[model samples]
Target: MDSIQRKKLVNELISLIEKGNAHVSFKESVTGLPSELRTIIPENLPYSIWQLVEHIRIAQKDIVDFSSSAGSESLAWPDDYWVEPTDTVTDEDWNNSLQQIEKDQQRFQALLEDEQHDLFAPLPWGTGQSLLREAMLIADHNAYHTAEIVVARRLLKSWK
Candidate 1:
């Protein structure tokens, strides 16, 4: 597709993703997760709802930063490369963060709409696909983890 067409298509999909993620709230989304479910590690899963949110937040923030300042030093990988699942966070923090993510996603989309295809090109951070590719990945990531939260809630008998 031509550059203008690409921009329009990218913007359309980005709008859908931004809007789609807006409706998903950590609390209501986790309506199915019970206290017990949140704590279970049946097979010693490396991540919990807490950990997942932490990872996603870090990722989204990184993307926004990268989008705005392509010349800034990129985020470096952790030397330890170990993710801790016990991070403490309030449900409110998670929801607010997600809302911010929606905003960031929209901004990134707008920027993409205004720049050349190379603007959205992928970097080494992750999802070495185009910006549009990474945005969709973000949407998929949110859906995947939000679904996990729902599973935890239902397992806890917290769902109505």
Candidate 2:
């Protein structure tokens, strides 16, 4: 692809991951969430806001790490991607998780923006996964969970 096209694609991926073009962004979904509601699992829902937030963080970090390096160790599926149910979600823990999510997101964006990384080339250590594919995965996964967070907030009457 030409430089112009690559730049445009990078910009679009960044927007999809960071902006609420068609749906709520992760930050917007979790912003101003009441601490009391962070750990409460709404009726019939399998996860709390805290769990979703942590899962997003963990999963995104794993993808970024895997994409940035060859032969990086992959986390165990399901178990490593999610946090256990906890009754004690302090402000510190909550803020740290949020900060990590933002940090790792920026890290992945940097990788995307770097010209050295070929967006379409498959990773040497992966099964034909390209940076472009991982970028889309991150955007899709985050969007799905962010919507869930919004739904949970609505059910808990904390949305808006």
- Using TM-score, give the best candidate's number: 2
lDDT of 1 by residue, 31-138 (tens): 444434443443434466655555566666666666556464566675222246553555676567667756776677766676544645666554465666666766
Tell me the lDDT of model 1 at 156: 46
Candidate 1 displacement at residue 139 in angstroms: 2.6
| Backbone clash numbers for all candidates listed | 8, 0
TM-score to true structure, per model: 0.60, 0.97
lDDT score at residue 18, model 1, on the 0-100 scale: 53
RMSD of each: 5.0, 0.8
**TM match of model 1 to true structure:** 0.60
True-structure lDDT of candidate 1: 0.59
